[model samples]
Target: MDKKQFVDEVRSIAEGYFERGEFFCSEAVVKTINDVLDKPFDENVTKLASGFPVGIGKSGCVCGAISGGVMALGMVYGREHGQAMQEKMFPMSADLHDHIKGIYKSTCCRVMTRNFEFASPERKAHCIKITGEVAAYIAEKLYDEKVINK
Candidate 1:
């Protein structure tokens, strides 16, 4: 599949999961990516990302989507020790970071969540949008890196 097609599919999955209350932002993105990739990581460790949502326990330090994207990248390219792996991990993480930054103008959950009415339906809708798009973006990057086939 092409990037556009892959993204569209994953976005649907992520958005649906969020809408159904199956998972929050970070979990939704990670689960969508892993599911699409045929479950590369152990399910037990998948919960490691749960702490990232609400910007690290609702402190809003970093966007949960951004954190989830980075974790997904690590799941593919990480290694115990190797410069080659480091090359992939660091650059791709930064690339994901840059993409989110460019989109929201900031990677902080608080900042990205700004400009919307607090506790409003629209705010929730925007978060759902982010949850999907961020998953799609990570999936696209993995495909582009040839780490996974489309």
Candidate 2:
């Protein structure tokens, strides 16, 4: 899909706000990116996120956005060569981390809330939408940068 098309698809998914429970925005991003790349949804990424939003237990250890980004990165370039692979992945992982961090710095509940339990219903909805947007933006950027292909 093209950039506008991808953004529109994400916007549609995020339009409906949710007050509680895990949002499927992360899954949506994975699905969209996979679609764009003509790749299947990586089972590992999906599994990693199965308990998210809820698994956070309202603590927000790693923001869902970053967590989801890590999942996608793992799927694209997971370790197989042990230590060497781990070392090689540092820069790549850092790139993904920085991308998410930039977005969070601008508008974030994960930073402000400290504890997810403190998030108001409005904050939850905002975070839900933001997570979706970040996922889409990163996925599209990777595709455009030729880091992945359709």
Candidate 3:
């Protein structure tokens, strides 16, 4: 597949996971990125994203999708004990944050979904779209960085 196709596929997969109720926004992003990257981390790594859905257990702080994207970035750029942090880590994370904030005007879940009633179909759809966007963004960044080949 070409780069665009691969990114779109990543987005679709994440959206499907959320739409099917198999996972929430954060879980879907992490799970899809892990899968697309050929499972660099264990499948169970998705559990790490579970608390981020609905903005950190529904406190509505950051958007779960963006939070997931940051975690996905960490999966790629994060360091272990005694290792220096990857130079790209902080910049890439900030880039993802800016990208999402540029589109939504805020990264706060409550702010983004304020127009929709919680639990309504509209809200669900919005979240699913954001989840897919986040996944696609990560995929594109990875491809551009040559972290993943087409």
Candidate 3, 5-54: lDDT as tens digits:
99999999999999999999999999999998899999999999999999
Q: Pick by TM-score: which candidate is best?
A: 3
Clashes of each: 0, 0, 0
Model 1 RMSD, rounded to 1 decimal: 1.9
Backbone clashes in model 3, listed as residue pairs? none
TM-score of each model, paired residue for residue = 0.90, 0.63, 0.98
RMSD of 3: 0.6
List lDDT for all candidates, in order. Answer: 0.82, 0.54, 0.95
What ranges in model 1 sit over 4 Å off?
81-85
Report clash pairs, candidate 2. none
Candidate 2: deviation at residue 73, Å? 1.3
TM-score of candidate 1 versus the correct structure, residues matched by position: 0.90
RMSD to native for every prediction? 1.9, 4.4, 0.6
Tens digit of per-residue lDDT, candidate 1, span 73-139: 7777777664466677888888888887888788898888888885787877888888887888888
lDDT of 2 at 95: 70
lDDT of 2 at 85: 63
